[model samples]
Target: MPSVTVRNVPDEVHRAIRVRAAQHGRSIEAEMREILESAVKPQGRVKLGSLLAEVGRKAKLTDEELGTFESVRDKTPARAASFE
Candidate 1:
């Protein structure tokens, strides 16, 4: 099995990870391995935020242009409810 070394972890973060490992009955190394594995695994759905970002970048959609569309949407008044 390949091994990984994470450096410069903050004291607070290390303490938090240790606490979480204890909560889950895992060693720090096992918790870290679980965390790493979870990160790289497929999430089983589209990530909308990142997909929208990529789309906007590829289509060159500017913030101002998107904002203009939001501001200029049709504001049709609602019709009164009719009872049969």
Candidate 2:
């Protein structure tokens, strides 16, 4: 898993987060993660996969047609780009 380090937080802000974390019965780190997650990907967001599936449903694509797409698609591993 990846990790993040937030530097130079104001004392009052840190204290507020600590209080909020305590109120929610979560560690400060866990509370911060939840805060960051909600800030970026909120509950009302429309994700791409859901949108595409909706489009497919409206288009009335059959399972056999979708299976043909899978059979014809590329399965190669991508190569890293060289900056040289």
Candidate 3:
């Protein structure tokens, strides 16, 4: 086992951690560990080119249609990207 010390934590942040620990029925240390784990994890990225290629192959989109579809898709607002 290794010991670690975190210094100069703000009072409000410490108070929030204490509140979250109490809400979750965990010690502050355990709550902090869980928060750190989620914060530091690596996440996946979507490759739009690869995805479009796969969709084209399956759907047999003509070059003109594919271009049109891509143009339309490009104009759409992007939603949040998540990896879970």
How do the predictions measure up, each by TM-score?
0.50, 0.55, 0.48
Q: What is the TM-score (0 to 1) of candidate 3?
A: 0.48
lDDT of 1 by residue, 29-80 (tens): 9999898889987888676556766776798999996667557656686577
The C-alpha lDDT values of all candidates are 0.83, 0.86, 0.85
For residue 10, what is the lDDT in candidate 2?
100
List, residue by residue over 1-59, the lDDT tens digit for candidate 2: 68999999999999999999999999999999999998887788896556866787788
What pairs collide in candidate 3?
none
Clashes of each: 0, 0, 0
Q: Locate the minimum summed-lDDT window of 10 residues in model 1.
A: 66-75
Name the candidate, 1 or 3, with the larger TM-score value. 1
Order of quality (TM-score)? 2, 1, 3
| lDDT measured at residue 29 in model 1 versus the true structure, 0 to 100 | 95
Off by over 4 Å in 3: 43-84
lDDT of 1: 0.83
The sequence of per-residue lDDT tens digits that candidate 3 reaches over residues 1-84 is: 466789999999999999999999999999999898788865565577778778897998888977877676655666778998
Overall local distance difference test of candidate 3: 0.85
Model 2: runs farther than 4 Å from truth? Answer: 47-84
